[model samples]
Target chain A: LAKTTQPISMDSYEGQEVNITCSHNNIATNDYITWYQQFPSQGPRFIIQGYKTKVTNEVASLFIPADRKSSTLSLPRVSLSDTAVYYCLVGEDTGGFKTIFGAGTRLFVKA
Target chain B: DVKVTQSSRYLVKRTGEKVFLECVQDMDHENMFWYRQDPGLGLRLIYFSYDVKMKEKGDIPEGYSVSREKKERFSLILESASTNQTSMYLCASSLYLEGGETQYFGPGTRLLVL
Candidate 1:
């Protein structure tokens, strides 16, 4: 498991595009960047994942630079409901079965 | 949708009492995990079970033990609950993927040890 660094908290206005960045200085070559979202008492929910460049999804977009040292999670047209802690996890293929989460970035979408 | 069911949504236990947290996943995922969440500390894995009767210790397992009698059911045991053990416990299930795969989580079990 690689240690990740993300903002403790971020505030954004509704309908704004929110991008949260995570830095993994010692990211391994085999590691993949995965982000998860969680509400107050719920488990973190998977948002988007990427290995390099950019990967877009219906709910969010994951931007990973070529170096792969850092990644950003982009949520388009955020709403109040999008307020949650966003976690960035870096893990290798554990025979295809496990990913761990660190303290995620707390995202607050204001109206 | 994959449903990861945790037996208790909220639990209040006395110090030195034994506590058991049960999680069941309908998806029949190959892996099941238990994590505890705190205010400043993010999520910490306590234990994980990969197969029936197989278990592994995670980052924080000092006061925890886990059992996987069946693939779909994983249980966390607190031999003696303490005030420090009071926190929200989360259950998750996932299938292996080539890269890091997504993990689906349950609502959570809020345990209060007094």
Candidate 2:
């Protein structure tokens, strides 16, 4: 299992774009990068996932470098409600019990 | 829109008591997992089941056990709960896709042991 490291906290104003980066230096060849967002008192929700290059969805975007050792999660047009803890995970396609979630980046969107 | 439902949102239990946490998913996924989330620990997997009646231990499985009787239901059992077991218990289900698997989580159960 690859351990992930990210910022403890971040601050952003409403309508601004925020990018959170995660480092997984020991990522495996078959591992994929995934991002999840969790609000207070709620379970984490999937934001985006990617193997390499960039992947975009309606909620967020995931950018993975060629080495696959690092990834960035980009949230566009932030709002107060977007304040949450974002987690980056690296694991195999069927990593049921092996998926590791480290202390995620807490993003505070101010209005 | 995959939905995972937990048995309780909040629970209180006494030390040495037996605690059971139930999770159900309607998506019929083949894989279900049990994890505990702490303040700085983020989420630690307790156990996971890939199919019915099969389970695998995760990183921190010392005080926890799991059962998967059916494909849609997974249960976490703590025989003798302690104050240290108090935390947010999360249940998730995921289907193995071609490239990767995306886990869908329930609202989570906040367990407090005294």
Candidate 3:
């Protein structure tokens, strides 16, 4: 498993854009970058995933650099409902299923 | 939509008592996982099953055991519960993808042991 490093917390206001970066220096060639968001008491929800370059969905966009050692999750026009803990995970193809979560970045969205 | 349902939302157990945590998924996913979340430790994997009756120990498997008799159901058992085991228990299920697997989680079960 590739270890990821992200900020402890971030603050944003409504209608503002929030960007959270994650560093995985030991990322493997077969690893994919995936992000998940967790609200107060709910399970973590999948936000975006990408192998390289950029991938966008209805909720957010994932920007992966050419090196693939780091990735950024960009949320546009944030709202108070966007306040949650964001986790960046590097998924590896180990012929089996496994997921390890870190402390995660807590995003505080203010109204 | 993938729905993972846990047997209980909150549970109170006594020390040295056997505890069982049940998880069921409606998506027919091949993989199911049990994890415990603490204040600073984040989520630690306790056990996971890939197929029916096929189980694997995760990072923190001590004092925890799992059983997967059916495809959609997975159970985590604590032979002897303790106060230190009080935490938020989470269950998740996912399809087996090559590069990455997107896991859908349940609401979670907050267990308290005294």
Candidate 1, residue A66: the lDDT equals: 84
Chain A only: TM-score of every candidate?
0.93, 0.96, 0.96
Name the 10 consecutive residues with the lowest summed lDDT in model 1 chain A: A93-102
Q: Model 3: per-residue lDDT, tens digit, B44-80? A: 8999998999999999999999999999999999999
Per residue, candidate 1 scores C-alpha lDDT tens digits across A44-83 of 8888888889999899998898888899899999999999
lDDT value for model 3:
0.91
lDDT of 1 at A25: 84
What TM value does chain B of candidate 3 have?
0.97
Q: Pick the candidate with the highest DockQ.
A: 2
- Given candidate 2, what's the lDDT at residue B98? 78
Per-structure clash totals for the candidates = 2, 0, 0
DockQ of 2: 0.75
**Candidate 2 chain B minimal-lDDT segment of 10 residues:** B94-103
After superposition, which runs of candidate 1 have C-alpha atoms over 4 Å from their true positions? A96-98
Those runs of model 3 whose alpha carbons end farther than 4 Å from true positions after fitting are none
What are the candidates' individual DockQ scores?
A: 0.69, 0.75, 0.74
iRMSD in angstroms, per model? 1.9, 1.5, 1.4
| Residue clash pairs of candidate 2 | none
lDDT of 2 by residue, A14-89 (tens): 9999999999999989899989999989999988888999999998888898999999999999999999999999
